[model samples]
Target chain A: MTGVAGVVLQVLLVAVGSPLLVGVMRQVRARLEGRAGAGLWQPWRDLRKLMRKQAITPAGTGWVFRAAPMVLAGTALVVAAVVPLVTTESPLDGVADLFAVTALLALGSVALALAGLDTGTAFGGMGASREVTVLALVEPTILVSVFALSIPAGSTNLGELVAAAEANWLSLLSPVTLLAAVALAIVSIAESGRIPVDNPATHLELTMIHEAMILEYAGPDLALIEWASAMRLTLLLGLLAGLFAPWGIATAGAGALGLLVAAIVVVVKVTVLGVALAAGEVFMAKLRLFRIPELLAGSFLMALLAVAASYFLV
Target chain B: MPDLTYTELLYLACGAFLLTGVMVLWRRDLRAVIRLFALQGLALAAVIGVLAAHQGDLELALVGIGVGALRAGLLPYLMARALAAGGEDRETRPLVNVSASLVVAAALAMLAYAISRPLTELAPSPATRAVPVALTVLLVGFFVLVTRRRALSQVVGFLLMDNAITATAFLTTSGVPLVVELGVSLDVLLAILVLYVLTNRIRASFGGTDLDELRELHD
Candidate 1:
């Protein structure tokens, strides 16, 4: 019963905390731009409105058109379940390894790409092609960076990685961790369709990689995609915060009080990261589509440096 | 007792090699061939996982999962997308037919088994079992690369060759060090990305993924 309760609590935290993180980012961006933003609960309100609205689908769409959002949301939920967002110990921790987490993310992207191509629109197909092209590069960076960390940890489990990071003598100063953190941050932004790699706010089809793919979706479907998108952004950020900046996360065997403290730490860290991401978006313009490859290649090079640094430094 | 005997695993690895060779002969579609390649990866991963889990080594478990995820899951997924995007379906014309290909693959496997037999006899039980299987898979993968006209199949064959090497490493000893295993997997992942990018360019340039067209290249 206690194990089940822990699982339930961790899941609820991820589900509830993700949108709040998104809302905080929006609020921070608005404040940065010298305008009062919507309340932190604004994402909830928007999601509710979207849920109640009628769905409108374009003609000539197939089953994949309807299935994409569900798959994306499902994938995000699975990732949240597997990743230790608030605590190092969770019931579902051992069932999934880091490789599984990576697979879940890749599954989500593939579903989105299929959905984009199913529309038979030029922009959708183009976006789908470009997204996979970026993915083919970005996925390796994610794998390599995490592998560098996993090597020192001696395990591929996320929980183990975090514990090792906390217990290690040079967790923060290790060149491998440093390079991986930077590589992961860049990959996170690219994977989540954020600034420099992709612009989330722009409706201009020519420049939009993520938005262009989902132009045909509206109402409930769009809401789910948007929610899943927010959840994914938060999930990736939380993963980064937990693995790289795992200062306050509840260690295994810590009691309820420890968990509560960890939750607070997590919320604060993710909120701060959300703001930093927003600031980055506010400061930088999106890279050209062709230029996106260079950014991914640079991240891959950084990840390679991380592994080499681990070997040389340690 | 261990869950599986070392000799049984050796014979099983050899059987898996033969089965994958047969799979290569059976597949006609470019995408289907990639799927077979992934299945071959799964078989190798399973054997490695068994060996690692039996020996109670966490490093091998981690390596097993990483290889399974990359070779069986991500690589196959990427290749499938490339094939779909390339749209070269129903147009597969191999450089060699199935019967002739199977005969050649069988001959190659026998040749590899004969070549590795003496060296393997000097090794330990598990290592000896894995050696021939590794060599056969390697030879067949290269054969597939040479015989397949589709660029996608060639890429799958390339990855299969890597899988054979990794399997050999695991069977030859307890396992490679964790650092080497992670590095090799990362290397394979990067190689797959480059392959995907090249496939796209190949599609755009030739309007088909057939290597026959690419052979027209001359400088």
Candidate 2:
């Protein structure tokens, strides 16, 4: 796998595998609750049906409302490109730094929030407000978490950071990594609008946070938004896997056998993570919207500890 | 390998100790404060034990054992008993809000680094690099004392302040002299005894143990 080919494969992996991961999680969640859930191909089927249908735009919404889902999906695709999935050397390696990645995610969130406000509904307004607040709080955690790795990596670039971790795999065993991983995991769940922050399977108007913004979208637009969010989840989990234990991510110029092994390793890691996350979600209830900040604060504290440990210890 | 790793562990434990002091400033629950205080003490003892091991000093290892037993264990146990008997399980108000105190703690940490830079340069040891964390803990401990309302929490803050000093002395030089360690640990036990007695008196006199109630005595 050359650099360009590896980057293309990584992008395709996220775009194609994103829906399946969502489906697997749903099935796992359903099984944990003692029922046969939708099959693993359900998200693809949902996307197909959605694409065939006509998208309806609301009467009183502007271009931002119409454009939000595209921007959201587009930003997610860019992030997928930048994040190393099954390769150590990305062509976009320079731009795939931590701060750049976070800023892109923030851009998507802001676009969605603006769209939420543009809809002129109380639910959209409230959800947008909540999303921005949560986003601001979680940003520091992500920064500190990433900074903890950067301390040893000597650079914030995701590629170099992964390389640094891979070079000294023992650092991954440090208490700093433990704290950062926990912080990053919690931040990932909240950022992706997963369980405990906002339930993906839910659309109860009163309890929904992410869905409130998408309430006005009808057919294809809704499909795009759904796919985009799922892709973001896939990319984040992939990033986490790459950072913590990227033992098998194919490097540039690796043989086909290496790429095959990388693919299998990535699938196993992501599947295990998806199932673990779904299983964990089954036991925990969605926290109150107010309480979510407290959780994020705790995550920030953990990340702060990681940063402090790296500073003083390492 | 063990010496280098243990020295690093000592530095990380110093961070934990500082974090616990900041936590006492952040949390309002009395039990949470006591738990964090105990964690700080544990971290303190771990730092001592790790450094003692790295240096291979038997006397310092003995002091580490004593610190773990008294500072981390016996003292917090006694404090928990006092808390239960006093029945003031929450610190309802503070002189400053949590967010403000967090900012102050950060600023004080910066100040600690600035003030300790000369000392750190003088020693030029890996352990001396953590002098600021020890100083930050000392400052934040007093911040906790000033902000928190509960007498038991204030006592924990006082203990935290003392622990930070111990950490500073240990990190900057060899572990504090053995006889001094014994004397200070005893001083802590006696201080806790007096604070416990005073807390009970505050509770019995004013029907609560909040330090704000003590202000009523000035009138």
For candidate 2, give the lDDT.
0.83
Per-model DockQ against the true two-chain complex:
0.02, 0.24
Writing each residue's lDDT as its tens digit, candidate 1 over A1-314 gives 33444456666777887778888888888898998999899998888998999998789998999999999999988887778776767778776588888888999999999999999999899889989988987898899899888887888899889888888635555546766888799999999998888887786888888888888889999889988988888888989998888887777677777777777887788888988899878889887676677567666655664554343233
Candidate of highest TM-score: 2
User: How many clashes show up in model 1?
Assistant: 0
Candidate 2 DockQ, CA atoms: 0.24
Candidate with the greatest lDDT versus the true structure: 2
TM-scores computed on chain B for all candidates: 0.90, 0.94
Q: Residue A227 lDDT in model 2? A: 94
RMSD of each: 15.7, 2.8
User: In candidate 2, residue B173 scores what lDDT?
Assistant: 84
Scored by DockQ, the top model is 2
Point out where model 2 deviates above 4 Å: A33-36, A173-179, A201-204, A283-288, A301-314, B1-3, B86-88, B93-104
